[model samples]
Target chain A: MRVLGVDPGLTRCGLGVVDGAPGRPLRMAAVGVVRTAADDGVGARLVAIERGIEAWLDEHRPEAVAVERVFSQHNVRTVMGTAQASAVAILCASRRGLPVHLHTPSEVKAAVTGSGRADKAQVGAMVTRLLRLDAPPKPADAADALALAICHIWRGTATGRLQQAVAAHAHPRG
Target chain B: MRVLGVDPGLTRCGLGVVDGAPGRPLRMAAVGVVRTAADDGVGARLVAIERGIEAWLDEHRPEAVAVERVFSQHNVRTVMGTAQASAVAILCASRRGLPVHLHTPSEVKAAVTGSGRADKAQVGAMVTRLLRLDAPPKPADAADALALAICHIWRGTATGRLQQAVAAHAHPRG
Candidate 1:
């Protein structure tokens, strides 16, 4: 299955796509950033981001999506912007009924580097090693996104049946 | 000068335009929602929104842009979506070299209704009264956007020069 993962930010959003089964080597399909100018107002930058995502989605057409859930941080301003970026990713996935899977940063770190507290460089190094790539993912956001997708494949493949059963049990009426 | 105002939302976005001068009534040159299907995914919906804004800009050639700054709400999901939508407006204005203005919800209400705590209905009524329109702006977002534009005109026209002076004083080198 091809999965798209996104690390969203107001100025630059990281996107990566992986195609393969769980535990098996996943091929990197594409990776890039959706960039917006700093001088542009938040609204305009968002539009540009959206446009970039559209182009990416058209090119890749991943079957599923994984995104990092926004966590509360001490900085209100940063939290606010992150939340907004998260919403954009969610909206993009939900609108298409793409079945979005959200992962916490720690979970992604653990899945990628076998440690919950791995730094960005650590995670990037592991991603490169695991993927057997010559170099680490250039942009931190792109590496993070790739890690998120890989993590989803690892976790989702194992618990796929359990989750389906739980969903059936919980939403029996629906 | 002409100013465009936008209120971004998930399903719909409110848009309005007004002549950017004192004593001019807020003109509803166009008022409508930017609709996106619930199943369309964020990328496609965003394209629709950009097309809507681009069309408006091309048609009106507004010299400035104004948007309502988002305030935190209990619904995290909604707030996030709104922020992305706001980003679209900001990018549109910034790319055109037109100064973009952001007004808080309270400030917009106070400017239009003389009370910061005014409800939506009250603000809608006041917008109609102030603009001397034949009817209330349809789809609350449109009215809210119009109010934001009006707020900018009221505040910016009087103090825009003063603000420039103060900014220059604070950053002499800049």
Candidate 2:
């Protein structure tokens, strides 16, 4: 399945698209960052991010969208901006009727590097080897986005199937 | 000026609209809550909120949109949900090219009542008195929404004008 992963942030949002499924070799379709000036107004920054995500969606048309779930941070303003950007990504996917998955940072790390405590270097190294790229994606955020897409393909798909099975078992005879 | 106030939440989002300026008497144009089932998916809940806010904007065509700034809470999940909903409200207003204002809880309270530490009952009472309504708006959320509207009319307008003046002063050619 084609999946688009978004590492949501107001200053620099990471966008990556990967085509793969469970037990299949992953391929990178695209990777980039949506950036907004720090000096821009909040509304304008959000609009820029929205337009960037929409452009990516239109070009790639991924089957599913994966977003990094916002977690508590020492800086409330930072977390709020991340959450707002994350919401924009989810909103775009939902508007297009595509299923959106939210994976925590630890979850993505564990899925990509087999260690929940893996650092940025470990994630970048693992992503490079998995995608068979000569070099890791530029900027840590882009690599993180790729890791999120890989995680969704490796873990989110399985979890989704399991939930479907449970629901079917509860109401059979379809 | 007409202002739309939004108290963003997952289950029940409060919406209120008011018409007036800083010194003139304010009139309540609309007040209500947009609710979604707790069992609903996050995407569905967000879409419901987006539609509700859009409908209100379309009907009232408010001159500005004011949202309650989300504050950090002990519950991470609750805060994330509030931030997400708040983003949707901001997105709707931004898309329509309307100016969006965010007011802190204390700021809203101070604008409505004499004290920033005013409790819910105090804020509700002040809202009732300001709108000249026979009774306070039902549900604490709705009253809070009305208070937000009233506060924006009383404070945001002046702040906006001051910003404009500063901008004009910096660039006199325009």
- TM-score (all chains, Cα) for each model: 0.72, 0.95
Candidate 2 positional error at B41, Å: 1.3
User: Which pairs of residues collide in model 2?
Assistant: none
Candidate 2 displacement at residue A36 in angstroms: 0.9
lDDT of 1 by residue, B87-111 (tens): 6666667667678888888888888
Expressed as tens digits, the lDDT of each residue in A1-174 for candidate 1 is 888888888777899998878757878888878877878656676667767776777889988888887755335576666666666675566656677787889999998889999999999999898777899987898898888888888876667878888999999986
Interface RMSD for each of the candidates: 4.6, 1.2
In candidate 1, stretches whose alpha carbon ends up further than 4 angstroms from where it belongs are A1-4, A15-19, A27-66, A71-75, A83-129, A133-142, A152-174, B167-174
lDDT of 2 at B161: 93
Cα displacement (angstroms), candidate 1, residue A148, comes to 2.2
Best by DockQ: 2
Top-scoring candidate (lDDT): 2
Ten-residue stretch with the least lDDT total in model 2 chain B: B71-80
What lDDT is reached at residue A61 by model 1?
Answer: 90
Q: Chain B TM-score, candidate 2? A: 0.94
